[model samples]
Target: MWLMWIYRILILNHEISMASIEPIILGLEGTAHTAGVAVIKGREVIVNESATYFPPQGGIHPREAAIFLAKEFPILIDKVFKRLPFKIDKIDGIAFSQGPGLGPCLRTTATVARAISLRLNIPLLGVNHCIAHVELGRTVTPVDDPLVLYVSGGNTQLITFLNGRYRVLGETLDIAIGNALDTLGREMNLPHPGGPHIEKQAQSGNKLLTLPYTIKGMSFSFSGMVTAAKKLLHDHSIPDVCYSFQEYTFAILAEATERALSCTKKPSVLLTGGVAANAHLQTIIQKVAQEQDTSFQAVPRNLAGDNGVMIAFAGTHLFNTGKILSVEDSQVKPRWRTDQVQVGWIE
Candidate 1:
């Protein structure tokens, strides 16, 4: 009788293992100045899409973008869903950015996601915007804990993990790195979103115009450097300024990374966000890591820019931890911090 019971128990376990696995959640990322969506099955992203909007004149036009997102999101969501092998209803829950982005854009995304949850009678999970950005990239990048320098139009500076959360070890005291680059690029008559343009120009030129590289304690400042670059450009060639600007900015970034590494006593580093796409920055980071014999990880170009896949992966992690969101929970936050999040979330 005892032997027969053991056989039955083993057979039941086999049957359970054979049952189909369903996706844990659907992730929506609208925190980007550009909008995006990603579907995740556990920790793996299945479909991710982003629509980048270039301002007609200068800077992001909030009303224009809100209208754009409202019009474009449904189509993009449909496209992503169609690519999925299974039905959306099969998803265990829905996740959307809760805060830390353009208010109008955030509301538009939240409204749509909430409507989906209400219509489908499914639960929803709200995510912190900036936390999602860093976490999503970190999940895929190999860099463990040395430091994360996130430079973009809206944000810049140093990040480190501590007490089970990512903390802002240091950051820009003024304008973000991407903004400075773009502003300088504009002065050079380069196109909008000019970080790439500056980098391209620098490849053909040598550093002629010098710029300041500042690191005050754990934080750094970019306004002075931006001012100096603009002044120098009138007397110097554009390419030369571009080369020197890249060198100066990257040097400050590398110095901050090294400082963070030493302070935290960690040996791994990760580069993320839009600015991480710069080849020059990558070279500098790799060089510094090598000097310290530290490990470095950078997100691939596809994942570097803001996209939905990171949201999906983040949602997947949160879902498995029982942090699921309900329909009543659908809300947007314009300022959410990464370190405020509690760990022990899903794997």
Candidate 2:
């Protein structure tokens, strides 16, 4: 009893009171391509977490993704808080990507976020995952009212938001650019993750090989390009084919983005997604934007990849806009639309 009293006294003496936190936000990302989580104190991100799960086959497996998240979620969050380099008590709220992604994967992320919010007794905010990427990329860029072109493993398209609604200016009529690159890489017996490998090989490649550079009006098609490139492999070097393919496909994207700027009367362009890490793609887009006399915005290489920081940043934006999600709003919809967001996001 004497020892227990002494321990209690020490604990009480060490306990410190905290001030009211000024809206620290946490963001959850478990969409189609990457599973991640992030913590933000106002505009600055304290901790951003992400993990990659590559399937044995070509694409993502929902069941396997859920299993990976179940294990990684707690560890990542613990690592975040433990290594926070700042006060943990200042975290004010929670934010998460609510929809338009894989159902099983999103459920795993949402379950974790909901539990965290309950434990902290903080408000939970729902953010659109795509919009978060756009906002974060824009914040880091010098573009103002720019036409945005977002291309990733799961998404590929041209977009412009007008009057708080994101309008699809043009998009892939078939497979996404990354999807096509991955398929081509698999055919060439490359690694599981194909984008970087293909980009590396393209450096030595010549544009002698011919690939289908299909562009129909504002929309584009990469399926035909993948097929054509595979056929050329028998006659041309892999590097040559890869180079030609990059040139052909990125040209489509650049042309579409440029056209969007002209139509919207905006001389700025923002690029995001995993594919944005490609130096060739960035150079091409920069050249196009420069030729058109428009501003170009591409997030840093670290930020471009799917990470928790973007999610947390996105969630904080939602919280400030009064877009909180209720306890009953836990349903995970895999195919949520971007324009379906009714809340006032941008002015």
Candidate 3:
């Protein structure tokens, strides 16, 4: 009781005080091909809007995506303000995804966030993109001390909390699973963002072709498997190859997640990232969690993707916890790791 009181009185952080007294926050996210804006009041998202760049031909070109974000952000910001019930002056703070993403995308989002923070003179917070995803799962679900499986186009890792840090217990050594799938799709001459297309094909495939399964210690490797699948694409049916590819890849992640759970013994397993939208991977992770006698969680399909809501949600927490940044310090970090964040709100 005394400690709690002392913490409340002794903690002298302007941002944390503002968060506790004020209830509204504006958040921005453009860590990759998506540019978004969100308004968070207390724990609920009052406004969540995003514009994604989908290249008609190949994968996302960084420069093109940056240009697209530059064009679309104004429209998205306008949409949020025009639709909001309250005035813009009601917002208490501003937040943006600061790092662990593509350089151009991160810069575009950060620049806007900085401009807004200065214009409004509100407290500014730079959020971690990976940490934002985990925060989204927490906002929409009931999970505490969860072991997280974060998979996306640029990242793949099994993470959990211990000793005041979100630790990376296992990760991909080379390309992330999402990128590997996209690359495979490119190799097969399929469209960009091949995850959905691959999922569709894998459903019809009954055959499971033999592919290399690489798991080092608790980490995952998909580069070799992708190469081998490219070779077999000549003889095997596309559906069958896609099926085996998913099975192998998803199983590897499931196994690594299971190991993380066993090591940490956390009661919950939260599956997130763009790939969490996959039905097969969800089933596999759910099964692993159930078999381990642990709880399972997945963000709703809408919240499963990258958006400003997660970044905004994380911003709210960080502000309350006294993590405010100056405009000069609020630069983008394309290679920031999740484990480096000091999680002050989570207990």
Best by lDDT: 3
**TM-score order of candidates, top first:** 3, 1, 2
- Clash pairs, model 3 backbone: none
Q: For residues 137-183, could you state the per-residue lDDT of candidate 1 as single tens digits?
A: 66776654547777777677577777777788888889888889988
| Candidate order by decreasing lDDT | 3, 2, 1
In the order shown, the candidates' Cα RMSDs to the true structure are 3.4, 6.4, 5.2
Off by over 4 Å in 2: 1-22, 85-89
What are the lDDT figures for the candidates, one per model?
Answer: 0.77, 0.78, 0.88
lDDT of 2 by residue, 1-347 (tens): 99999999877656421212235777778775567877876556677878888877766677887888888888888888887776665666677777767788788888988898888777777777777777777666666667778888877878777877777789898888888899899889888678899899999986666666688777899998898899989988888888888889999998887777777876778889889989989998888789788888887888886777787777766666777787688677677766676636577
TM-score winner, 2 or 3:
3
- Which 10 residues in a row give candidate 3 its minimum summed lDDT? 10-19
**Residue by residue across 1-347, what tens digits does model 3's lDDT show?**
99998777767576666548656888898888888899988778899999888898888898899899999988999999999998898887888999988899888888888888888788899899999988888888899779999888878988888888788999999999999999999888888899889999999999999999999979988999999999989999999999999999998998888888888889999998888898889999999999899999988788777888888888888888878999878878899998889888877
C-alpha positional error of residue 70 in candidate 3 after TM-score superposition, expressed in Å: 0.7
Off by over 4 Å in 1: 1-22
TM-score for each candidate, following the candidate numbering:
0.90, 0.89, 0.93
Clashes of 1: 5
Error of 3 at 36 (Å): 1.4
